[model samples]
Each structure stands twice: as structure tokens, then as C-alpha cells.
Target: MTGDVWAVGDAYEVYVGRWSRRVAPLFVGWLGVGAGRRWLDAGCGTGALTSAILAAGPADVVGVDPSRGFLRSALDTARVAGDAAALPLRDGVFDAVVSGLALNFVPDPARAVAEFARVAAPGAVVAAYVWDYAGGMQMMRHFWDVAADPEHDESRRFPICQEGPLREAWAAAGLTEVATRSIEIPTVFASFDDYWTPFLGGQGAAPAYLATLSDDRRRRIREDLRARLPAGEGGEIALTARAWAVRGHKTAG
Candidate 1:
């Protein structure tokens, strides 16, 4: 998930957005957002987390992403096409700021966290969640483990997605009460093809990496994943995805 493809913002609703629903409530719940408060969903891809915030009864919500197409899809709230490191809104206006599955993709997560702290009022909450790329993000782990293709590296893409780095980014940004937890969600596939077909769409890192391979190589990779995945009697494969989530509050003035 580079800055380039994320700029397009199409089909991700079905690919990333669909799967991210599993952890949306968990992240928003950890946020503990209440009603009648303004919220900012930074890097709110396709309104997944934004929708969750709305459901939790926030008075207003604003979603910002670099992708215009994603902003278009995120029709439930105020939308802005912009970068996370630099939001074009006034400072100290929001009651809470949150992002989901986004920090790892941002050009500068530390800067983004500082920005989240910047736009938040004193004592307002700042929270975000990212997939555990090195560990329990099963789909990605499986793909990277089996693919072994040097054309792309997931670690380079998600340097701050783990527990330690996530907490460090928040603390370095001067946020207080910095705390983190792991949120696990189910990733159920109707069949192996249900899970395998999306990788051909060329949206995320796996798909993008697969795009660079020859047709035969891609087919082989697919077959290898099919073999490695454990299927149930009904041909369904159930996997758990774990995302590391962090939350903190801006210091009171």
C-alpha cells in the first residue's frame, strides 16, 4: 500500500474495507468516544472507521484521506482529500482524533501523531490501530511467508505497526496516558478462492507485489497459498487477524 495506489481509492471498499470491518468496532470501542462530540478520522480509508464513529453517536465527524475516491465513498461525514501529516483544519477543534489501518502507510507516522495531537483540544483523545504485519495479520503473513519474492517488503512499509513502535510514536508526540492493546478479529473466507481472488486486484502490498510476477509465478503462488491454508469441512477457512491499537490523550492546557 504505497502513496500512489492509495491515491486511487477504488475497489478497496471490497478488499481492505470489507475485512477491516472485523476490527472497526474494536478500535472505536477502545476509543470510548461518546455522543455529541466532534471527531476526526485521519486517513479514514473508505469510511470504515468513520462509519463506526458515527454509529457510536458522535455529533459530527470529519474524515480525511489522500484519496479523493475514498473521500467520495465516505459519504457519511465531512470529507477532505489531504495528507495525514498535514491536515488543513483548525487546531484544537476536535474532541477526538482517530485513525485505522492507516498509520503504517503514512509517510511520517510520528508527524501524523503530532498532528492528531495538534488538532485535538486539551485532554481530547487520540487513537489509532494498525495491522500486526510482522505477526498475527494472517493473510499478509501467509502471503509474505510463501511468496518469498524480494520485489516488495512488508516490513519497510509498516515499520510502526507493531506494539512497541506504536506506543513510542504516541509518547514521542507528547500524548499522555499512552496505552496499547491487541485487537483480534475473524477473517472468514467462503472458500480459498474467496481469499485468493482479491490478491489479483493489485490494490494492497500483496496484490502489488504479485503484479510484478510472471503469470506462471503468480499461479504458482496462488496454488502454494491454497495448499498452506487450512480449510474446514464446508471449504471455509477461518483466520484471525490481530491489529495493534494505541490510544492517548492530549495534555490539558
Candidate 2:
């Protein structure tokens, strides 16, 4: 399997970042954490969630991700270069720990949940969200369907994006009151170009697969998607994206 390329922030912004930003506030609002708390955004690619937390008036927010390139483009939060599975932060230090649209990418998602639980203060909220690639994330779902590679389809590759797996992971992390919900948002593309150009960015899973294809194959795939996608009179392609969000709390001391 070709490793998902996540280095270029600008390319990522064009790929998934734009849609992820739409999900951030919804995920954060679902968390409903109180203001004036310390927050940690694990796997905080480009600080989407971190920015939302900051807007909610957190006393402090720290965003951590392994990609320095993405971190450089992140908002004004304190950014750290680190992996989610083995966070380089002290234990029980944050009032809230969260990740957004990134949990499925971790090699060991269970271990990353453990790390989220570990870094959270007692009774602190620990949460994360991932794209519902199997069904509701239409942008990628349509791409994968047209791409026709079952092996590389994100829905097959990341089972943890579903509600059951996410709830189970949170509970298995020893987190209390684990709950999950779906957040849906509009992803409107100006035209076929708006929808297809991001695939050429070479950032996420679909784009990475696209990069491996011959020009003829790529062109065929593009035309297939252009025909299959539902477009409006003005060539606007409007789709809905859904993300599964899970939240739980550590047992208070």
C-alpha cells in the first residue's frame, strides 16, 4: 500500500482540509466542553480543531502532529511535532483532549485512544472524529466507487470510522460515558474542476492512489466521476460529508 502523503499543507487544504474545517465546529459543539480549560489537539493536522477550541475561549490549546509542514500552516496555537499513538506530553495535564478527521490514519488507533486518555486530566473530555467513508462522506465515496479499487478504498481501509468501533475504542480506553454521533456538512464544489482538481493535489488516500495511475487512466477516472457526480445547472456539485464523532470522560479522581 502506498503510504498516504500528508506533508504539503497547501495541497492538503485543497484536498480534505476544506471539508474538515466545516466539520470542526460541529464536532467541537458536540463536545460541549466548558470554557477556560486546557485543551490538547492530538493529530491536529493544520490546527482545524485547535482553531475551533481557541474560538471557544480555552485557557490554552496545544496542537500536535508529526507533520511539520502542516504544523507550519496551523493557526496561532502552540504546535508540537509528535505522533498520536505515543504523545510526547505529560500525563493528566489537559482538561480536554481531542482529534479531528485523523484517528483512522494512526497505525494503532487503540493505542492513540489510550494516549488521549493518558494525557487527559481526570474527568477530562476525550474525543475524536473520523470521516464516514463507508457511506456518508460522498466526496471520497464517489471517488472510490469510480476508482474501483476495493483494496485501496478508504471505507475498507478504515473500519474504525464507524460508530460501533469508535464507541468500543473509547470504552476500551477506560473512558466513561462514551457516546458517538454523526456530523454532516455541505461540501459544495463550484464545478467539476473544483471537485476533481483536489485529486491531483497528491495529499490524501484517494489523491495518492490517483498519483500512481497513468495519465490515460487518470483522465478516464476523472471523466467517469464528472459524469457520475450530481451537478446543478451552473455546474455546482453539492455533496454532504458525514463524520463519526465520539466523546467520553476519564473517571474523576
Summed backbone clashes in each candidate are 0, 0
Q: Would you list the C-alpha lDDT of every candidate in the order shown?
A: 0.83, 0.92
Output the worst ten-in-a-row residue range by lDDT, candidate 1. 1-10
Best by lDDT: 2
Residues 1-253, candidate 2: write the lDDT tens digits.
Answer: 9789888989999888988888898888888889998999998888778877877775599999999999999988788999999999999999999999889999999999999999999999999999999989999999999999999999999999999999999999999999999999999999999999989999989999999999999999999999999999999999999999999999997
Q: Please, what are the lDDT tens digits per residue for candidate 1 over residues 1-253?
A: 3323653455575566787877888788778867899999998878888777777774698888987767776766688888899999999999999999888778788999999999999999999998888868898888888887443557556779889998999999999999999998888889998888878777767777777789999988889999999899999999888989999999997
lDDT of 1: 0.83
Clashing pairs in 2: none
TM-score of each: 0.95, 0.98
Listed per candidate, the RMSD to the true structure in angstroms reads: 1.7, 0.8
> In model 2, how large is the Cα lDDT of residue 31?
87
Which residue segments of model 2 deviate by more than 4 Å?
Answer: none
